[model samples]
Target: MASKKHNDHYTDYFGITDKKVPFEDLDVHNDTRLFLDPHLVRLRTSPRPYWDQAVKCLDTFLETLTVRVLSRNEDPGDLLKHIQEPPETHLGMARHGYRGHAASDVIAQRIWESLTTDLYSLFRVGLLEHIEDLPLFVRGIDRDITSDITTRVFFDSLAQFTMSCMRQIPELSSRGTIQIEKTVWDPSHKQWAQRTYTVPKNNDGSGIILIPRGWVRKRLLGSASRFLQTETLTYIQHSRAQYDHRGKLVTPSKKTLRKELAKEPHQANIFYTEAAKRNRQNLIAQFWQYVDERYTEKGPNLGDGLARP
Candidate 1:
């Protein structure tokens, strides 16, 4: 049986929640509701296409802020204290910025990776193990329904992961409209470096929604697809539009987001939801064949005698 629950938590507490609430009635697709995890946005690995640009962006962004703040001769702790004060809350150091200590940077990197990639990696591995063990439970399920249920379980776990990452990265929120939010202070410029985004409104009453830039949408979703079903993966990608550049998120699109947003949620309950119907059907078919082969009179029933008198 699928665990029906996962170790993941809501992305809002991490300072990523959608700013604009969509209307009650618009039909929104699942893919448009996503956002990236800030923790996962980092300098790329060596020899990669974006590696140079990634390094330049990070170094420039960090250096610009550090030089300005260092001029104060203020202790790091005092700076944290001063910036943390109310009214100027907008100017403080967020989890994504350089906080002046190598150790802090290392720790932050660990935390970032653990929450975003590490968490999902573990979840996927666990799911694979569960799927491998699923045959044990399939015997109790109906021939017509087992595969469908298991596949739904598989995709639902992926969807949950997508919802989570959408809440982590802020840029996916304002895909078409340019809005800049100052995230870190720059002493040299006597100002702040703002993160920019593009937001577009839907024709329906649901109002403004975020979409990923053409390129980003292609990349992350491409990566997510290998482990998930096509439509289910696309739905997760579309939901990514929840994050705007400032690391603040927006509400997810209603159609796809509702399952994750439900009260007293059971992650497995998603298998029973309408959104998962097709995938569930596919799952049912796939597992049914396995059950037939393994439990039939000629097939192995490795555990059959152990439970009998």
Candidate 2:
């Protein structure tokens, strides 16, 4: 009872290829043998997490397209009618063995047109609303993956696709030239203040300095524990070797250091030294300050009355 043409269109849109290999027969390491292109085959065993995230971004973009652009009357099943219909290349050709390369190209082009139009509209809305939509946009791109290609190869193709589309947007292309200043906590003043350096609009380099809170805690605690262990070992060893050339103990301070090290590392008189506490507090304060500066919305600054007389 289903229309054959409709079925074909759905299959093509979803990229349901004729390859009959069952899931049980598929193996990640052996996937190289599945593709026709040698370059694509090489990506069979490539890092998956990175590609998975990339695919997720693509998926998100497609989801946005479906939700924001598609009409209520149309379903994904109607994709064939929307796509630029490909020409019939081979007469009397069996559909199973013959790869519709030209048809694939047409489908890809139409999808790109749809994606670019929707993405540009989304960008315009975000600009007008003064909203930070880059994260959501990136997530949108990561959400739509209906491909059978290997993770690495798929991401490589996706990167090229995204780059091609983004190159057409002038605003996004000029993003690298724009810079904004971020505020930070000034330890000396004990108040929030603007940073001297301006960061790029894209904020690509911020990752190097903006460490996660959990990572900071782990690193700080780990370093403190290691330092305590080393100092404790050093004090115990020094106490035994503190005797003078005449075999009489001259440095009586070793006993005091040993007693101090014997207390719990977090105790006020022991490992919780003033320097250590100050360093920890500074790290925490800086992290919170960074969060406030990056996430908090500041009131608009009204320009000082006309011009000074």
Candidate 3:
């Protein structure tokens, strides 16, 4: 006799045969490349209290981190309290994503050092309003890394968010729950703490979550993609721009811009950051607006992604 075949998709397990589900109906068997974006969280409308709590958890820690990094003297231990390997929510693009992935120590230390050194210097000239923008200037950080950090810092809120989602759907809420432990921050006591939440779990025993479609993008709004599109690029263009005899702007080709960007004198974070500061107000507004208008899909179901012949 053959063993029973179960659906790996959350909706399928929950008996949903609909073409589309409101939340991200995740593939419970493996990790997806989608990221949990904070910008989208702020814009979310459903599950009001959960989104609010998620925002609070994220902001409280990030604000503290910014202040600590700016202080340049305090031990980063408290601020880094919740910085650790995130519990696999079966959401992210790790190489072996279902197993979960994150650089435990080096990333934490590097972010701390950058905040104190390079980022602090950049702040003096012009500050990025969203820490989500760090990947553009920070050497090795990317969306996946930030997503991991977000999951670690805001685990409880997300767990609760999942709770809210599960309760709203009958098939899931009726399925009962499993208890799981996650390391999180104790904002009141100013330390790290272990916390537990009852949530739906995978056969692999990892907890699963359904992110709101509104609170995610197929590709996150990353600084690497948008950095130059902002006024910063205008600044870079002007600085490297050639002038006609009459002082008319001479547009540089992409090739020219690349060559200039590669040159030693033009390679420092200072030049770009300084230019960014010149239009700081506009830069902040434009980036958020770009997030609002682009990428976030309205109506579609994510296919199983494992396409084959």
Best by TM-score: 3
Q: Candidate 1: where are CA atoms >4 Å away?
A: 1-39, 43-55, 68-72, 75-198, 202-309
* Model 1 lDDT tens row, 1-309: 112132211122223355442111111221111122111222113223333333333344334324433343222322121121111101112223111112233333332333233223222322212222222212222211222222121222222232333455543343322222223433344333443222232212122222112111111211111112322333444446577788876644444544453431222222322233433333222333433343354322222221101
Taking the tens digit of each residue's C-alpha lDDT, what string does model 2 give over 1-309?
A: 111232232113223354331111111111111221111122222233433443343344334444434343223333222221111111111233222222243454444453345334443332211111121222121111112211221223323332332343323234342333333223233233443332112222220011011111101111222333433334334445566788986543534654665454323222222233334332222322332343233311211111111
TM-score of each: 0.19, 0.19, 0.79
Better of 1 and 3 by lDDT: 3
**Every candidate's lDDT:** 0.27, 0.27, 0.61
- Candidate 2 TM-score, C-alpha based: 0.19
Off by over 4 Å in 3: 1-7, 17-20, 95-97, 124-126, 173-176, 186-192, 240-242, 262-270, 276-286, 289-309
Q: What is the lDDT of residue 267 in candidate 2?
A: 31
Top lDDT prediction, candidate number: 3
**lDDT accuracy of residue 107 in candidate 1:** 37
Candidates by lDDT, descending order: 3, 2, 1
